[model samples]
Target: MSMLNEWQDYLPDFLDGLVVTLQLTGVSLLLGLPLGLGLALAMTARRPAIRWPATLLVEVGRGAPALVVLYFVYYGLPQLSLTWSSFACAAIALAFTTSAYTADIFRAGISSIPVGHREACQALGLSHAKELRLVVLPQAIRVVIPPLVGFCILLYQGTSLAFAVSVPELLSRAYSQASITYQFTATLTLAGLVYGAISLAAVALMRARWPRRTPTITAGATRPPEPPTRTHPSWETTSERRER
Candidate 1:
């Protein structure tokens, strides 16, 4: 009963924190996904100038730990006279990290297109942009969706890192409550439960396979009779002429 009561108090605050966490995730993805696609395109370009810079950015983003990046945005930027609110800083840092990682995923999707398809597009006299917009991207989008959803789940969990920068997300709320009530175990446990529940739900939903419909024949169903073929005048038999 005591634990239940503790959860009851924590639930409201934690729910509010969850909202912030979701918002941060949405903002990060909104900014990052398009940027990631652009980077992927640049990375695949034939020109070294275009590809090298994008490659460098992805390497740095993927090479560095997210916490370090978050710290850089929150603390280091102020030295350059660039200051943002904690939430903004967290969003920017996470977005950069997301773009870097997703760039590879996007590149993989793009590369999965068959060489024959591009050659066909070229033979059709289609411009490079048209080839991508009409033929390549449509297929690539489908391929990338499953992995993108997986990444989004990871990013949702990653939003917890924002708490380190005092962004008051779910984990931050849990820690704050723990500090005030000194119920570290209870608060932290509830927080973990909440995170686990959401993550598990997302995973379950993504893994669900919708039943596909197939043609079925009923007991009394029968195929319709074929139409009779008329004989051609030049090929009609003498017996048919006699009957006429």
Candidate 2:
């Protein structure tokens, strides 16, 4: 009844693969995050000079299939003089490619912010950058967090594609086990369970920790109660009282 026995026996080997999968996912996200944000900002730029090229890059990146991107990075890159290790190249390529996607995530988050927030900041005499860092970005980043975690889960799953390029991550590990044991179905089932568990864990953890608050609470627009008596001693009130 307990699956702990399998883990107890091969815990170290599984851990090694788990560590590689986590690294592949983490490095991609770390590299992609800033790049995505910068790209999102650039795409949203008012200047056509900035917007056009950035827009092009975002569009092209989004348009291309991730697996194709991986293939090009792995198989195509070395056709030139440049050479890269399998793990390094896969990480770099996935990072840069997914950065484009993450940029869109952030861009949407940033744009979802209201004009009034910026105006309010302006009224307070905060500069554009300060407003972004202080008022706008905080909210946008919050709005983006759930989805970004969702994307991280996605990136975690996508690490399986690293097998295409020969990175010994979960998928590659499973493939190795399959070749030796000829239990491809069982091995792949285990891989699927690992990926599912990771994604569900991400979702569950984010929900438990954050559990998105209602927009009204964060917006601070709740009205105060009216005074019980407008003014007991007011002339109008006194006149009405005298009449009564």
Candidate number achieving the greatest TM-score relative to the actual structure: 1
lDDT of 2 by residue, 1-244 (tens): 2345443434455567778999999899889889988998887777999999887987767666677777888888889866788888888877876777777778877777776777789999998789888987887786677667766776787787788888888888878877876766666777778777887887789889887665432344343211112111111234433432
For each candidate, give its TM-score against the true structure.
0.84, 0.82
What local distance difference test score does each model get? Answer: 0.81, 0.73
**What tens digits encode model 1's per-residue C-alpha lDDT throughout 55-119?**
99988887777889999999999999999999999999989988987887788778777667788
TM value for model 1:
0.84
- Can you give the lDDT of residue 6 in candidate 1? 95
Best by lDDT: 1
Which pairs of residues have clashing backbones in candidate 1?
Answer: none
Clash total of candidate 2: 0
Off by over 4 Å in 1: 209-244
